[model samples]
Target: GGGSSSGGGGSSSGGGASAPAPGPQQPSRPAPGPAPAPAPAPAPAPSGNAAQVAISFAKAQLGESYILGGAGPNVWDCSGLVMMAYGAAGIDVGSHSVSSQYNTMQARGRLVPFSQRQAGDIIFWNDGSGFYHDAISLGGNTIIAAPKPGDVVKIQGLWGGSDIMPYVGRPG
Candidate 1:
């Protein structure tokens, strides 16, 4: 009877020992100490004004070819150019879709009428289907965009059309 009781206690103690040991070990091990290494990732992240950085990066891609879904480094589409430009500035809108990009701006920034838009504002246009084109404003009524499938990234005058309700979004 005594042996049975001691065996039960020993079994429970053995299990409890491993469980608590691992729990403390996880926190005590160097695992958390090396966590500081990944902190540098956010350190080198884009730190300046988002619009300025985005505009600078977008302008640098002036001659890149336009592809329907390209995301830069050479080629880009309308929304892809906008996304990559902002991403380079450390403001990720998290998508390649024009509508989704617009939503991100709507959530993070304020809408500015076309008449009051400034350089670096994100301007949007309808692609016949709806508001499906995006560009980086260069102010003075010009914009940097990938245009269309056969075009290259270039600065062009903003389109004036009532059919397309063009709008501007200022980054935060």
Candidate 2:
């Protein structure tokens, strides 16, 4: 009878041993502490200004080829580049056409005088009959554009002439 009682006591201790197994795993959970470090990395992107975020996205595409209607991960057109840049910042300018983008900005009351333009403003151009080209302003007199077919996206001095629209679109 004493041997039977001892056997029962040994079984109870086996259950106690299982509890310690989770104790060892508690230390492994601390390894996930470093995982939170990466969480803060994505925080800055959200806190940064939208215009700056769009500018950064456009700058990354410099040297990519230009296609007449491309809106892409590689090639882009004038309005397409402007569209995707602001799209990266979570602002939708609508359509891949310069005229449509200008109208969208106007409808949203985002049009500002060209003299008040700042970085990330969408600058449109009217060659003669209608709004035809667009680009993202880099502040001052520089702009990033995917000018015409066969050319690559590049930052160049802002074009000044009768063709430039009087106002620039400031998408939030």
Candidate 3:
């Protein structure tokens, strides 16, 4: 006689069943803020030789979308950006990782100091962590970087963090 149509007098997990969710479910935490953006690609400051090709490439893609490993008219990563930029300028320099690019140029005495950074130079930063971040020094303390996902190629201060730049590897 006391039968009820509402769940047939049974409990429902939909706000009615009082069963807490499984194990220590941590409260929703926001994704950590993305690392600082990279500097913009600098204009040709030296002899203005073929460096303008890189400058033109970077300038043309000022707002292109940035995907971690993307390399195209739509998306690009830090290294991919550099590879494409120089490639557009007819330079054959190509590197997959930030460190590899750095090492490759380092062995050739292309690495330069931040003070001597010129347009088209590749800057790599190690935040004391194992991973590294990179950007193209467009001179004037501005660098071109593809940052992380959801971030497009943009210009920001050369340094992403407290790292004042320990070294820079110039891409010829």
Each candidate: how many clashes?
0, 0, 6
Local accuracy of candidate 3 as per-residue lDDT tens digits, 1-172: 8774554554644455357667987789777887678965443234255566886787788888988778887888888887888788776554767777767666666666677778767778776664367877778788878887888889887666665456676654
Residue 71 alpha-carbon offset, candidate 2, angstroms: 0.6
Off by over 4 Å in 2: 1-48
RMSD of each: 12.8, 11.9, 18.6
Order the candidates by TM-score, highest first: 2, 1, 3
Clashing pairs in 1: none
For each candidate, give its TM-score against the true structure: 0.67, 0.71, 0.66
Q: Write the per-residue lDDT of candidate 2 for residues 1-172, one digit (tens) a residue.
A: 4554333545344354534455345533455445543332121122238789888998999999998889989999999998898889888997889999999988877788899888878889998789889998889999999998999999999875889999988886
Query: Who wins the TM-score comparison?
Result: 2
Q: After superposition, how far is residue 8 of candidate 1 from its true place, in Å?
A: 62
Candidate 1 C-alpha lDDT tens digits along 15-75: 5443344444454446544554432223122223887888888889988899998996898
Best by lDDT: 2
C-alpha displacement of 46 in model 2, angstroms?
Answer: 16
Candidate 3 to native Cα RMSD, angstroms: 18.6
For model 1, the run of ten residues with the poorest summed lDDT: 39-48
Cα lDDT for residue 94, candidate 2: 79
In model 3, the runs with Cα more than 4 Å from the true position are 1-47, 162-164
